[model samples]
Target: MNSKYQDFVPLKAIPFVEFLINEHNFTLKIVHQRETKHGDFRSLPNGKFQITVNNNLNKHQFLLTLIHEIAHHVTHQKFGKAKPHGKEWKTVFQHLMLPFLNPEMYPMEILPYLANYLKNPKASTDSDVKLSLALKGNIAAAGKNFIFAIPQGSLFIFKDIIYQRGAKRRTRYECLNLANKKAYLFHQNVEVASYQREYS
Candidate 1:
């Protein structure tokens, strides 16, 4: 195991971590939670390549995020700053994920969904509700209610704003914020607290 990544990746993920480091020559770092992204890769102005993954992810999520970022690094090396999630990146991402698409690397529940997801990869795992939900099942429940748990037309609070859940549009739920009366798309697996209805 590389001493540098020993602290960031779990024991079960060491092999994959080593593969990325040795094969791609990337410097990996696991940092605190990043709100907008699970992981990212960049080439330093000094020419050093680095990848950073959020430390809060579970082992399975960590591995997936790491491989996703590694795919970006690989794509950048081959194509030189093409679209971030373009065809080249998707192809490389699926290729890197092929070896780990099994019960050993991921839970059986998530494996199938993950395999399907790789066929036409998206920008993020969160964008795939089935796969994201299956992955979330592997970790301890956060005790927060999921957006999918709320009935359609039911009001809920997300990020401190009140919204009414609407019809499902593929993997996301369409919602209307009460404050702004504007429609928004939310991930199906987003954790939200339910609001109690008040009777007049």
Candidate 2:
């Protein structure tokens, strides 16, 4: 286990990290929080492979994202230029995630959801609402309110932008950005600080 990533990944997850580094010769990097993606894998021209995971992720999410990126690395090695989340990657991801499905590795509350998710994993954990919500439930709630908790037509601040919640569209909410009045879809569970409207 590398001393540098001690603070990034939980102690229990160190063995899996070591396995990836030793078996695949992968270089691990903990990057700043990225709003769009959780992790990424890149195979350099010099035959060096690198995996980067978001620093903001909790223990479970961090480990999951690490394995997800490693699956990509392994898939790329086995079949170059293959579909990103094709059958090969799913097989690798499931195999790698099998050992961590127990209560010892994950909280009992989230273990069941995670186990079911592994049966047919999606491109991103966020795509699985149940699993994603379970994972988020383990983490401490932020000071900001959750988007789904707010009323429709409520105004809120998200990523420094103001938006008014419109209508529910399946798993996401339609929000109109106040700055440019452009509509965008946001996950129903996204956290945002509510902006109190002033009465004239």
Candidate 3:
């Protein structure tokens, strides 16, 4: 295990994470938070793959995002240019996540939801409302709010932008951007602040 990343993931996940980093020979970057994404993987112009995970995530979310990005790498290696969140990537993500899904890596409160989510993982963990909220519990901050937790017609702030939460559209919540009046669909688990506060 690399001591350098000890603070970023559960102790039990360190060695496996390190092994993936070493074996894949790709760059893993812990970057500042990006409101639109938790992590991403891309092949660089220099002919190397780089995976970046948001620095703000708690250990559990961080590990999940890391493995999620790694699954992309593995999927690409196996089936070049496969659909981003297609069956190939799903299988790879599930297999990679299995070793880290134990209680040692995640709290008991999140296990059931996490297991349920892995049964058919989505492109973003946020797509799994229960699992996303369960993981957010590990964050140090208190009184965290989510889009789905707020009442419809309520004003909330997300990514420093104000929006009025609207009706549910299938899985995501429809929201009207206060500034542009443009409608956008937000994942149910997207963390948001009350109209008066700034969360991100």
Q: Which candidate number maximizes lDDT?
A: 3
Tens-digit per-residue lDDT, 1-200, candidate 3: 55989989999989999999999889999999897899999999989999999998888999999999999999999999899999999999999999988889888999899889989989988778778878888342445487777899989877778999999999999999999989999987777778755544
Residue range 58-86, candidate 2, lDDT tens digits: 88889899999999999998899889999
Residue 161 shift from truth in candidate 1, angstroms: 2.1
Q: Relative to the unseen true structure, what is the C-alpha lDDT of residue 21 in candidate 2, on a scale of 0 to 100?
A: 75
Instruction: Show how many residue pairs clash in every candidate, following the order shown.
Output: 0, 0, 0
Q: What is the C-alpha local distance difference test score of each model?
A: 0.83, 0.85, 0.88
Residue-level error in angstroms, candidate 2, position 35: 1.7
Per-residue accuracy of model 1 over 1-200 as CA lDDT, tens digit each? 44665555456667866876799997887899986899999889999999999988877788889999999999999999789999999999999988788777787878889899999999999888788888878333454578877899988887678899999997689999999999999987887776773311
Candidate 3 lDDT at 59 equals 89
lDDT at residue 95 of model 3 (Cα atoms): 96
Residue-level error in angstroms, candidate 1, position 89? 0.9
Clashing pairs in 3: none
* Model with the higher TM-score, candidate 1 or 2: 2
